[model samples]
Target: MFKKTMTTIGAGVALAAAGVLASGTAAFAHECFNPNRSEQGNAGASHSQAWLTVHIDELTAGLPEDDAECVLDAYAATGAPTSFTIMVKGAVGQDGTIASNNPHPEKAGDGSGIDEIFAAHGADIVGSFEECGVPMPF
Candidate 1:
């Protein structure tokens, strides 16, 4: 009986260890279009269109909120971001539109929303990448 108890306990410990290994190593496995942690839930895309890697993000106010020099490295078609064009909604909208200063408003992808804005720009984006310090996990 004692032998059996030890064997069972040992098996349980091994299984627990394996679970931790798998979950920790590949926690962020899904490919992200935006490099900025600020834009994690926002929409975007990654492709080889203009041979240019584009990265943009929406900050709570600024990328990394308090830090002035935060770099959000986006995953490029080649896999990583070089820079970003940050869009901040300074103005307001009546129903659902953000009265942004730029000529165009930003559109994050819905998967179905992929490259919708890019197609309109007449500018081809090659792929995107970025480099920001790790975001503070809430």
Candidate 2:
């Protein structure tokens, strides 16, 4: 029957498609040899480590508003990073300190990033960092 033939072809197509998708997912689940991933995903599973805690407050004695700050670490592919940046979200004054805080990082937004408050230290650098290499894909 024509209907049976169509069903058979459909099943074959589906099986082939599934195999391709599975292979693709397996390839990407780890790391793939894509030219665009040249930047680096993680610092490598095994390497160096560092930590910093930032603090925050009203730099001025009379301001009612409080501020948040960040402490960061620097790790180069081979050695310590000469310098790094803690990109402050929104507009924070120019005088903030880095430290560790409670509940670990209270990430801002949809948790796209993480934040560690040194609220206990009243704002001080108290976090760990690491540096590693980008592994080659299988």
Candidate 3:
């Protein structure tokens, strides 16, 4: 009976360890920002054009030339308060996509969302990738 109890306890410990590891892996996998559910509140609000431009340049500093240019162009065209999210896939510059989700009054039903903006600018749509540095447990 003691041997059987020991075996059961061992099995339970193993299962618990596996569960912890699985949860950690899952957390790492889905750590990216989800704009749909958690949009930045009043992003770029009360910010100057120079400030915004500098902010964007800072964000896209290490990105590919084309990708960075695409982001800049899209932001420029908007001419509104905007927020940018840089998504890097594989490695920075090699594969990346920028998302500019601005809350502009005119954007309603205007087809000027990130996908459309990227498409309009001839930027390659890398789709969604995990955004690192986002707070975990999100």
Candidate 4:
């Protein structure tokens, strides 16, 4: 009887562990997509929207699909240095707020703070810019 009870307990523990892992995986499975031209124009970036639209896929490569999409829109919309800085700052602010994270980095901030987060976390995007002939100002 004791053996049967232990087996049942072990099974329950395994099931519980699986449930936890599944939930964690789900949390990280974000989806990214291409932005419409209108959305790209609205990104408020100083960099050329034309350039961003053409090279977005290259810049965003190797990132989570959703993160790539976020970077594309953010980069395209950055209409000025200040806007670019704010978008980068916002993306960084939302890094720890996993539950609230989304593709719209610009929507995440009040536009205050340093914009170095991209330098640390945006290698693919930055590299794409360099390869495509429009390196970031940082």
Q: Which numbered prediction scores highest in lDDT against the true structure?
A: 4
Report the alpha-carbon TM-score of model 3 versus the true structure: 0.22
Q: Candidate 4: how many backbone clashes?
A: 13
TM-score of 2: 0.19
Candidate 1, 15-129: lDDT as tens digits: 2332342234221111112333333333232122211222233211234453323423232232323333222211134222222222332343222222222222212121221
Clashing pairs in 3: none
* Candidate 3 lDDT tens digits, 4-62: 56534543433333234334412111111223322333234213211111122333445
lDDT at 68 for candidate 3? 64
Shift in Å, residue 54, candidate 2? 59
Scored by CA lDDT, what does every candidate get?
0.28, 0.22, 0.30, 0.34
Off by over 4 Å in 1: 26-138
Residue 56 displacement (Å), model 1: 45
What are the per-model numbers of colliding residue pairs? Answer: 24, 23, 0, 13
lDDT of 2 by residue, 3-118 (tens): 65654454343333322433441211111111111123222311112211111111111322221211122112223222111222212241221211213333211212322111
Q: Rank by lDDT, descending?
A: 4, 3, 1, 2
* Residue 120 local lDDT, model 3: 25
Which model is ahead, 3 or 4, in terms of TM-score?
A: 3
Cα-based TM-score, every candidate: 0.19, 0.19, 0.22, 0.20
Candidate topping TM-score: 3
lDDT, model 1: 0.28
Runs in model 4 lying further than 4 Å from the true structure: 1-54, 80-138
